[model samples]
Target: MSADSKESSVRLIITGRVQGVWYRAWFMEKAINLALSGWIRNLNDGSVEAVVSGLRENVEEMKKTSWSGPPLAKVDNIDVGIYKEKIVNSGFRQLPTK
Candidate 1:
């Protein structure tokens, strides 16, 4: 889809052994490579939380990839919420661990 036609953002909470397994770094790489913009961080509850904003297809791709996570991550579940949001120029980033 054209960049201008894309309009969606997804907040994802991934559970399991996601923290301390390079999940953030791996997600950053994937997002950047897909030309997606968003932020990812570790939660105090041992889950990895992320917000991906971009084209609908790209955001969906990100969610799909997140389900597997890094090889070291044992993803047990992924909870997602979709919302309408304006697209921004921000690049992918790994936020401070919580």
Candidate 2:
């Protein structure tokens, strides 16, 4: 399969009022709905981090939707980068804070 046709993964570091607003849960729900596989967690720096893996289109959509997180979250910025590693989990999950 062509590279573009395969699943893609990205590591997103979302900042600005992301924590404490149920961002992780919201993200998990979105991932599940998108039929994605990966994990979401909260960092100690008040930012939310997630590794999303899925079809290229789905991954792109997730990246866009991340900017407008949960209703209570005031998302300032999202740092997105290609995640080279594979996602072992078969389904999306919400992990403990780091």
Candidate 3:
């Protein structure tokens, strides 16, 4: 599928002070606002990882938003990868830290 086409999933790895800053909650809010389906969680490496699925524009917006997280969050870098899958259909969620 083209970049502009509606995507089903977008995996992201956000680094920096993303953990312990309500980043997961903030991300869930953003995803819900965009009517996206996905989940956010803190990784064992102190980074935040997420997989969002929705319209192309919404997923793109989510990726952009990850660069500038919640006001208390200091996002250093955001890595994004898009994928075409059928594993997402639920609403946004803030997963437990791993």
Candidate 4:
């Protein structure tokens, strides 16, 4: 699909109290529930990064959910950007820190 379409991809870099709070697991659960295809991982900069691709509505929902992360997370900011790469996977996963 084209990048301009609604069914696209987004990379989210979420900061603040995100680490050590099961944020990646939470994100994985939500993304899988939404039937999204992508992966989430912890970054070296104490942030959580995720690449989510699916229906625009589901992806948007995931973005909104990222703000409230797992109750223990205090999300300060989420830098959302378009991700041009396509996801070859079929389910959500938690990748190793990068």
Q: lDDT per model, in order? A: 0.84, 0.89, 0.83, 0.90
- How does each model score on TM-score? 0.87, 0.92, 0.86, 0.93
Query: What TM-score number comes out for model 4?
Result: 0.93
Q: Candidate 3 residues 1-98, lDDT tens each?
A: 56555665888999999877888888888889999997888899999889899887888888888788788899888888865566457788877877
Q: Ten residues in a row with the worst lDDT in model 1?
A: 1-10
Decreasing lDDT order of the candidates:
4, 2, 1, 3
Q: Which residue segments of model 1 deviate by more than 4 Å?
A: 1-5, 84-87
lDDT of 3: 0.83
Q: What is the lDDT of residue 80 in candidate 4?
A: 100
Lowest summed lDDT over 10 consecutive residues: which window, candidate 3? 1-10
Candidate 2 global lDDT: 0.89
- 1 against 2, candidate with superior lDDT: 2
Which candidate ranks first by lDDT, i.e. highest?
4
The candidate scoring highest on TM-score is: 4
lDDT of 1 at 56: 79
Task: Give a tens-digit lDDT track for model 1, residues 1-98.
Answer: 34466557888999999888988899999999888888899998999888888777988888888888788888999999964465475898888877
